[model samples]
Target chain A: MAPAIKKYGITVSIGLLAFIILVAIFAGQVAPHDPENGKLDDRLFGPCAEYPLGTDQMGRCILSRIIFGARISLSVGIIVVSASVTVGTAIGLISGYFGGLIDEAIMRIVDSFLAFPSTLLALGIAGLFGAGFINMVIALIIVDWTPYARLIRATVIDLRGMEFIKASIGLGMGDLFVILRHVLPNTLSPLLVMATTGLGYVILAAAGLSFLGFGVQPPTPEWGFMLNDGKMFIRTAPYIMIFPGMMIMIVVLAFNYLGDSLRDLLDPRMKMVIR
Target chain B: MITDERPGENRPLVEVYSLKVVFPTDDGIVRAIDTMDLSIREGEKLGLIGESGCGKTVFGHAIMRLLEDTTKVTGNIVFRGKALYSLDRESMRRLRGKEIGMILQNPGASLNPVLTVGSQVSEVLVLHKGLKKRTAWDRVVGLLGRVRIPEPERRAGEYPHQFSGGMKERAVIAMGIASEPVMIIADEPTKGLDVTVKRKIVRLLKEVTVEKTMLIITHDLDVAEEVCDRIAVMYAGELVEIAPRGAMFERQLHPYVQGFFQSLPDRGLKPIPGMSPSLIHLPEGCRFHPRCNRATGRCRTEHPEMIDTGDGRCVRCFLYA
Candidate 1:
């Protein structure tokens, strides 16, 4: 990659992610039309001045639905990531701090979760719980937390032998205090980088489940469900699938790029080229 | 500081009896600290000197009961007439930082980089004394000043990265003495420091530990002579000779101790013959027999125990036996 592209990629990724967040937060006002209420008279229409990006199979404004879909994707991504990170970090700290049988048991369980392809596991879980927004979010969180657990566990294990930690323990601080003050803060930078990429994966996974009819029910206008709604009409009106598909792809790519740039900025191993 | 009037001044503040530390590795069982006995008198400064990897640090850790659970430790450590090994987990935790403080080597690594120096020092007060944060912060500033740090009030708020090497060491020392523990174990506090810094630290150590019992572990003979009343020499996981600072320096008994002093830069600058024996497979009789210039057949086949050489001195060599 050229230096110019590398710099611009970071800028563009930040800009796009910021825009998506703003769009999600203000979906109620930014959207020109009600995403759920459709007009049969203008069904399958292509780009127009009043209803930009044309109409979908329901004759709903594709642009407005895409804007609304941003809300679900972003919220699900944020909620699931936060929940998983919290749960996983806690488990990982405990497992790594007290090694031996406890460490063995926890790591084996984490390994089992990691053995199956994450998406497939999410699919199986979502299928078991039955399709709905909450159930799908639950499924995503269950699969999502395993990676964070493993990441934190590895970091905690590395920090367990650090001189500072041993010193703190010798200072008579309880195990909990040492983990909170010494171990957790050191794990933050890598955790932040991992979370950014994890957010992108979560958003993509949620969309895939929605597209497969295991996520949010219809009339909700989620990007994945919108894609599902437009799939049957792909031949007659390609714009229906193209618009939402583009939205999902762009958002995921932005998050991934942002994560890459963050790693470069935060990673100690990277030779920082200050600009 | 050595008040003969005090009832327990002559009694041992900390005592170890037949202590051994063994680490079972894939290669073999590494006998880090062989069967050893030690005593630290109340209000006395004892310096333990040895070459690198001679189990000086391990012995320090063992005395504090800070060794890993995987290592096989079979011995008795008595602190204040209480058996340390028999203490429950909570009691042991309470004993640390309150009754006994430890100043680890590498002051830079001993402090948590993410935490402010003040907060790190204040944590000891909070945990052991149960002081509130506000009061603890005030005391932390005072403690920092006590350790010779300038502008303690302002510097206390700054993170560890802002402090220099000597300043970080002072902060670590402040943390160790925050609760005014009865005994403090300082492991090579002067190691890795330049002459000027080492002098300042040695002075600070003497000043802060005026009336407190201290165990200073170091390889610097000058440091031991300067700060310690009694000096113990360790060679290959065992004590070779222990005597008063003046006596040990003037008329040391063990060949290893004499060779050690001769190897110093200012002394004859002669290196001891042969390397220290490997701990995993130490020499059959005396651990230092291979490196001893005056070794005999008796020193080769039989391990010698510590022998009393009068005037509160002991030497673990067949010549003394």
Candidate 2:
């Protein structure tokens, strides 16, 4: 079990993720105070028996808000990654499988998108679309899918000529079935690794956008929104920003750790060395 | 049990008429198979023997239309009275694996590494035969049993990496014969296996492909002799000689064929002089003339056409002309 834990490295990360998820899911029941409702007298208060982690500028329970913020961050990470991976994988499969002119056309478009620094492109999209939840998600998705597409395309191109893929085709399997059953499954390990790592990036990007007031609105208690609100009281009340900032850092690190470990475990060549 | 209409009739199951396959590289067009003509009779096992890079595999790919679309293929490949080249992509795909199964050279690389051996074989059954999952699994285990794999039920559940070299080949053969194809194209079935394992694989392939039209491609004369009814010797990119297995061993006509036999360990270990000509810049006249002892001025200047020798044998040489 010790060796298995060391080999996988995701056990701790999975526990951390599960804890965060549980906190988010039970925020209403577990939170000591209402995230929205606040008393004027409690404003700028530090940790106490009644209000643990203290109250924010609005005198709302900062701990409760942060707990609720987990929901927003996790949802954004999951939804954005899901949408991008699915769309990107489909395009990559078609482009790499057919190749030739269709490949050329699709790849050139992917290339044009990849030409820009992704963050700058996301920023540009966010600026153009104006501040909103859906627009912010769209911006991140547009930027995020390029990596998945490129990774999947490269993998598909490498695997397209593999004997197993050719054998599947030779076995009279239709193009759709071959792509789904043979080509897609071969790309899964890398895709899984990419998605796990990409989840962290998505969460970070969503928070960045929200910090800039382009993501979930102020009243929503997202970690980024809390960070933005806390930035004002930094000198007088550093704890306000410290808590939300730590949450983001910890979640992102957890995903990164899991992703790295998964790469080691899932890679055939790497597994041999470890064993 | 999809049988040809006239099982005993004297009709060619597959006919290659002036078939040519050329690949365009950065340097120049590589003439892989140049004006090759041959035919495989129903239920006959034809051996395509050639050295490495001699277009034997390319010929098999051409028949299956497995080559990239950019490849320039010309002439006719008629299978069961239908011109294979004339068929559309979809129809051609349908013909492959179901009508003509192909076992590639390397079995290790042929089966999907991630998929279970059972799933790999069952995929063929489901795709071509439309068998349900339950039915495919039962048949897959039965097919594994037929290949003499120990504990077919347990072995089928294992991955390609879990199987040994010989077992992987057996699994690949199981997949190839899963659809019960009318014709099977096995390219280098016994290649890379040790002498003992080679015999076992040869015996296994021979057992499975019995009474089915087969094109077995290899450079091993002994394996060809053991399995093929008639052997077709390919030199450079042309069919130099094709004769019955017994006749090919007894009275080899083409100089290349003679050289190949002479180089065999049991024969003399006499290596053929010079190397196989590069497909990009093939030698003038006869491809084998540069190494031939009986080369004449005509052999250096004009390419010889394949001429019918008596007793259903054919040879390509100026001496024959």
Candidate 3:
């Protein structure tokens, strides 16, 4: 039915998601050594026997820290996006379903929140909330939710007038019930596209905050902090910066591709792929 | 299947007395429905005909209380001897789809795209009847079968996009009759269908809801003549003429009705005199004087009341004077 949710997008998305999950679940065991405990004599060793992907300036295993860092990045990203989607979708559904005064009030608030560029908003909130992973996620949720709410609200405005919605009403559903079961369920196509795409941004934003020293703190082994640590050794041991920077790019690009492909496949207008 | 109780002597099951619908726009008030009166008998197929923007659909929506909140409607719409205007939104919701169901001009847009044909049909059953999922699914198939959808079991799981135009209309029909509503208001239900498909859909609606009354809204006189027991012509937000189907086709009164029939595309089509008046600001006195070839000095000065022409036929025109 519906061509099995399309392998091209779903496969890559699920693949990356599974890989990220596996690393997060068993990062301690998967990484070869403790990220901070360095064997100083073997410091600055370039990709060789006892270590892999080269060692950082402190002689800590770059591979180990990168693998362990996966948990923090993914956790913040997933948590922030999930929280944002839930709040945004619910608000959007309520505001959009009951148009006029309710819609106007909700929209006015969303517009005011949307006034700030998302990253700047998140950074300001994160900076104020103090440096913690949970706080960063909370900050991201505040800025991120408005987009989902706005998009869903726009879509719902048009869809509410459709007969099926009327049928739902006729069938005996109250406005809230109908908005949830009928309206929200049908709006998954766009939400799904946003989810995967939004996750990458969430990941990048978390990493950026960490690199700025306002996230997770030093010795936490986040990709952004790893990159920041490596930047000082640009001429001496370039592997430190390149490796962590490469990790972010690979994951981000994979998720982005996965989102784009899934967006197309899930789309009702893409009849060519439907068969 | 027909109800024996009527409103009063020669009165119908539902009667709208001096129905008025006004819209407060930026420019001026749009008297969409200006003191119109009508009635529908139990088990009667009454066709409401009008040119574009003549307020036929709005009248249907107003009676259903499905109009926008911006609209200020003042009238006594009595159904089964109870006034309908005073009903709250929840009560109206109960009345709609349970007592009175409406189908739109576009079948494609009306049905929810995400839900299957079965789910959409069963939505009415589950909502109004409070049936369980299993019972709803079972009845969904039954309802679909009633609407002439072949291979009902398989078709139920399929989405709206899978069905053709005719099939989609049938699905909509299934949803309407799921609760066995007393009256079905079909607003141009066959507008987009080819003649053959249109004929099939009309036939399907008639077959499934034979016991229930239908207010079939259409601009086409032939469609009205085919299925409707009686025809009511609307123009400039008023009923210009009404008669039994046979009488209407054979001996019509009111020049507007005459003009509408002439405008009908008969084999090649009949030619009408002029366009319909705008509801926003209708011409004073008679709404039809501008279009009526028989318009006199008085036709412009005074509005003619809808009077019976001694054969159960009603016409609102000075020509009868």
Candidate 4:
């Protein structure tokens, strides 16, 4: 019953996210045809009774393909973010807590990673490792974790001077205990907000990589890969690109809205405005 | 020079000799504490009184070694016959809570907001005494009762924000004494509480620190008079006077100490003239000469050393010399 959830737009956003997740979870049962099955006679068909949205150049059902693609987009988004946040938070805690040569070294490496545009960095990494699902995920993780590290480090730096942290240390708790107990919990709200928002960006980045042919290889029901296959026939069979593109947009928007609403809900300074 | 002597006690518990703390900042180098010397005997309560920014808290942090690493600290701090500064980080960590406890100035800021009051206190017990969680919980409840926190069982389950200011302070005190430290430093324990609550806090502190040594830092003379056995007056980063509580109130030697007592509402409400000196650019010689009515040419040119008077009294002034 947070005030942010009471807003009409955010409620709808939450519902949309839930619906998308459900569809992704039950993709096989929800779709009428196999996403990979194609008929030569029905190639490039538009808005038939059986093919509601239409068919692609290979006569594959676009609706079925887009529904199954949700699974890939959501899974990649979740896994990559989870791995990065774990690694990034640990690095940030150590760097900020110890705060001397260690801080300088870690921060300089983070800065170097940040210097390159994230997409360009991911592209280079993916290109080097050779293109595929796991390589693309690795590339995305490398490009994504710096923001988490930087944000958490900044928060931990401020919290290290707080009296509670000093009191904990004065009580004979070691550095590890203080950082884990006193420092990490304080950073959680901001980290959560960042993670929720970062999910949308990660999904978009994954799709972008796939669109450029470095993601899920051919015949996979990934939305970005579908968009890549349909681009050549855009003028002739626009529905092939349009339906999958719309699915990506809706999922990303759902995540962005959830992230924004969570920020308003979790930030104590925003309580008055929310109320 | 007269040497002030207490009747029988010898070998002080904590001895600080010529301690200096300096911080280099963007504005200038802040001389926070300058060549200060003090001693606290076992089972004695010493009150440190000074204006804000006059190095009282800094002196306490110096004893605890809690100041930032960037700060420049010089001179020795001997606690329980061990040199505190020369100890390794692990040894210092062990000594901090087990031997010397600290109740910070702001209770609200000193308790973690996200943690339950019980867990925070029990953390100390578990860490220092190796008490199991279940046993620590019962001890935490007992500690809460000792501090006179009402509904000790239920209150322990609540977070800091759920408690009132006075209750928060009591909780902080509970945490401070959890390890049964030999010396407890309570910094402005009753700073923002009401008068009634202040008296209660003082009484609670007095009861808990009966046989233990304590350093109570406060600008309020009444609070100090209520708890301290001996009082040390600090002015502009120096210990201007140290005397028994009764002796200080009956006869103050340093002019600044006299000015301090005079400004009290019970003592004519006369305000001390001139602002406290900025630490960055302190006066050339005796720091108090610029504001002293009894100042002479010699007083301005010479920094007076602490001259001991008989019967456990000392003052830094030319009049005593």
Candidate 5:
């Protein structure tokens, strides 16, 4: 038999990603009823001939809702990571490499962002914007970019004085090209690790927002919605909480494991450890 | 000593006079280079030999202007008659890779690990000469081949981490020579390499830079003994002796030069006594007198000015005076 993780790691992430893509492409088809559609008759139906994983209090198929929920979570993780990494990498390369006033100004702003408790800050932004899919994503994106920016900045600082950079400077490569072509690629391995590991952080954060009732609007069928709905009937049926909570644990672990393996493969430094 | 002014022959390419570089620290100032005169003629290979902290490496960095911002430099670094210290940042930048290429001490630390060898070398070509990328890349491969890197085209694609120490140094040489600059400054080019590889690299440097001037800085006397046409001996930030390599060996003057010659392993080995003086808190008067066996009242009380010895050489000691 294959390793539980072989069924789990990249294959799971790729499948999750594909499933998300499919949900986005044909969410109307795979999610049998309208995500908002609810019938009182279907409420809490056990895993019978029709409903697998049973139905939530809304009487919708839990399995169908879970599939659609994956779309929102995965898309938020990807989009937030992409935006944060892009903005962070650029800011970091400039601040670290140029490093005087530009460094000072950027670091000051980044420090202010980091000064707040991260969750409070995200919640504050989500509260200000009012809850919906786009606002939740926007809130996460704003909250997450600072760490990336700061890491990129530090890495750039260390690399700026190196001989290759000096050699590039000496040969007359302008400050721009040197930072772009030479300095930027060196920042990738660490940046990628941040993005993947940070994916888990973002996913968990989004779930938290949903649980607080400020994330996805109700009747939309998200894990946080499922978890919230399950909590009320939890004394009667705790299995409702298990499925969604396990979904969270499994995905977060998969991302973290894949992040570790990716770091091993892409970063030459880590490769030395295992060998 | 003779001066031939024939048109095709060499004139001095760079002259440094009473060059002094001191670094300011929280505790005190560190004197890296004392007032000293040095000159390099066109197409000549000069070697600077000394123990650590003797200011040989500091002097090389001074030439490249690669010192920390805290350091204070006072002296004239005249390159082909223009004062180097006075040049604006842009002019200095233009001069660095194109006019004066340097092969740094630690190829590993100096090289950016991310860039492949070819890309690193080609970077200089494109920057200095405004050569197109493809053209510069081709020249980089040619330079790798010149430095004796096997499968030059293939090696060019590999990062510095992929190459052995010797190969990395070769790539460094390739970077140094890419622009075919007038002067090449190599600081400890062969310090850590095995004996065989050291010999190969030394031979390669001499062979390729036949008509190109080079200032080679190393602690290894044997390599200097073989490769350098002229040699300078440094002690405690002072140039105690600068002479034609053979003459310095034949008629060794100054306590430090004698000590270096005595300390050479191949020449009946024994280590030189004592360490270099701290630049931050140097001894009063003569810096070398503390370690010199021949020290007397006059030697310890006053610094000696560099005295020309009529034989195309100079020494900074009272004995020479």
Candidate 6:
């Protein structure tokens, strides 16, 4: 790819992400109407001067709702990614640094977790816990953490064999010290790339759970919740579903694009290939 | 430099008796070190020289108790009157870096690339000396400067990749000597450097290890000649000869050692014929018999024990016996 095109791709992704975050942060100011408040007379109204993306079945402004939906999606993504990365990295460091029966045991446990389809696992957990934002977050975290654990464990296993690690052990530094100072820092760049990539998936999964009626309840301005609210009126007025669906697609694509660019920038090996 | 009180001139600081290190791989057990015996006298610089696969580095690792857990090592390594292999984990950790420093082969690979050169060196001081990070860092700067690294303060802050190969070696050497360990075990310290750099490192090694006991493992005979008071030649995991450096260079007793010296560029560069035998499937009797020019029926049929030739020399050969 031409450098100019690559640079433009990065810029466009960053711009879209920034726009979404800004919309989320200033939703009240940015939205022309209150996302939750609606008029009974204007229910299922087509796109017009007053309602750009038209009103939902509840007469809620689809544009306003989509604007506010970014808040829930982004926060859920951030919280789940940070929490899972911390848990998985710690477990991975311990498992890889102390290989043997412990490594075997932890890896087998991770393998079992990975054996299940992630979305189905999250669905099962969310179904069991009942519908709520916190429950959905918990479910997403449970499924998401496994991949980070696997990724980090692989990285740690590679790093553990590095001559510097043996040198540290030979230098009389404790295993904990070596893992935290030497091994953990070295694992960070790859972890950052994984976390960025995983963030996009986490956001997509959160929206997926909400669409299935297992996330944020009705009347709450979430893109997935809006899609589910607009489902029945699809044949009569597909605008309600189309706008929120487009929002989800655009935001997810933006996150993934940004993540790819970040990986290319942060990873030295990738940098060589690109240049 | 606070020198430890010297014991008797002949007292061994580190003694290895009948050491055998085997790695049980999928193929078979690789007999890396087989029935080895060696002693480093107090304040003595002993060089262990050998071919690439001759287990010289294994002996260094065995001394430091740095071998892998799966490696089956059966031996007695006594350092400062304590059995090294039998020592508890905590004590063994305490003994390493604080009392015994190990300079590993390949300085570029050995130094942690992520950390600043200074912090890597100072980490030893903080761990063993119980010094605060600030003081440890200051001492690191001093150590780097002593190793003759220019702009020591600035260089200490830079990561390993920013430094050149020779500079990395100096930084590693500084780390080794940072804790003022009683003994230092260096594995091929001068391995992959230019001639001038190798000479500087050798001189630096000699100067820094003046009063401390040292074990140098190298394939470079010149390094051994320049840095060691005594030289011990290893052949296929076994010691072939032990003598003072000057005397060993003057006259080699074992046929293998003779061939080794003759293979040098100035000594007509007559390469020793036949490969060194595989460690896992070592030849019977003398390990070097197949490669010996003077291999006799007795040399092929019976292994020769180390025969003390007096004058602080021992040779493993039927001819000496």
Which candidate leads the pack in DockQ? 4
Model 2 chain B weakest 10-residue run by lDDT? B1-10
What value does the lDDT take at residue B224 in candidate 4?
A: 90
Point out where model 4 deviates above 4 Å: A1-6, B1-7
lDDT of 6 at A207: 86
Q: Which residue pairs in candidate 5 collide?
A: A5-A8, A171-B127
Instruction: Evaluate residue A265 in candidate 6 and report its C-alpha lDDT on the 0 to 100 scale.
Output: 92
TM-score of 5: 0.89
Q: Recovered native contacts in candidate 1, as a fraction?
A: 0.67
Candidate ordering by DockQ (highest first): 4, 6, 1, 2, 3, 5
Q: Which numbered prediction scores highest in lDDT against the true structure? A: 4
Stretches of candidate 3 exceeding 4 Å from the true structure: A1-17, A40-42, A170-172, A268-275, B1-11, B24-29
Candidates, DockQ: 0.80, 0.76, 0.41, 0.81, 0.40, 0.80
CA shift at A59, candidate 1, in angstroms? Answer: 0.5
Q: Sort by lDDT, best first.
A: 4, 2, 1, 6, 3, 5
Model 1 ranges off by over 4 Å: A5-11, A271-275, B1-9
Report backbone clashes per prediction: 0, 0, 5, 0, 2, 0
Candidate 4 per-residue lDDT, tens place, B1-321, comes to 233436687547888878899999998999999988888888989999999999999988888888888899999899998899999989999998899998888888899999999999999999888999999999999999999999899999999999998999999999999999999999999898899998999999999989999999999999899999999999999999999999999989999999999999998789888989999999977899989999999988899999887678899998988
TM-score of each: 0.97, 0.96, 0.92, 0.97, 0.89, 0.96
State how far residue B111 of model 5 sits from its true place (Å): 3.8
Query: Cα RMSD (Å) per model?
Result: 2.4, 3.1, 3.8, 2.0, 3.6, 3.0
The TM-score obtained for chain B by all candidates, in the order given, is 0.96, 0.97, 0.94, 0.98, 0.94, 0.96
**Would candidate 4 be rated incorrect, acceptable, medium or high by CAPRI criteria?**
high
DockQ value of candidate 4: 0.81
lDDT of 1: 0.89
**Model 3 chain B worst lDDT window (10 residues):** B1-10
What does candidate 6's lDDT look like per residue over A97-142, in tens digits?
8888888998899899899999999999999999999999999999
- Candidate 1, B1-321: lDDT as tens digits: 111123535888888878888999888888988887888888899999999988999988887778888988888888998898899988888888898898999998999888899999998999888999999998999999999899999999999999989999899999989989999999999877889999999999999999899999999998899999999899888888889899988988999988899999999999998888778888898888787878898889999988887777888888877
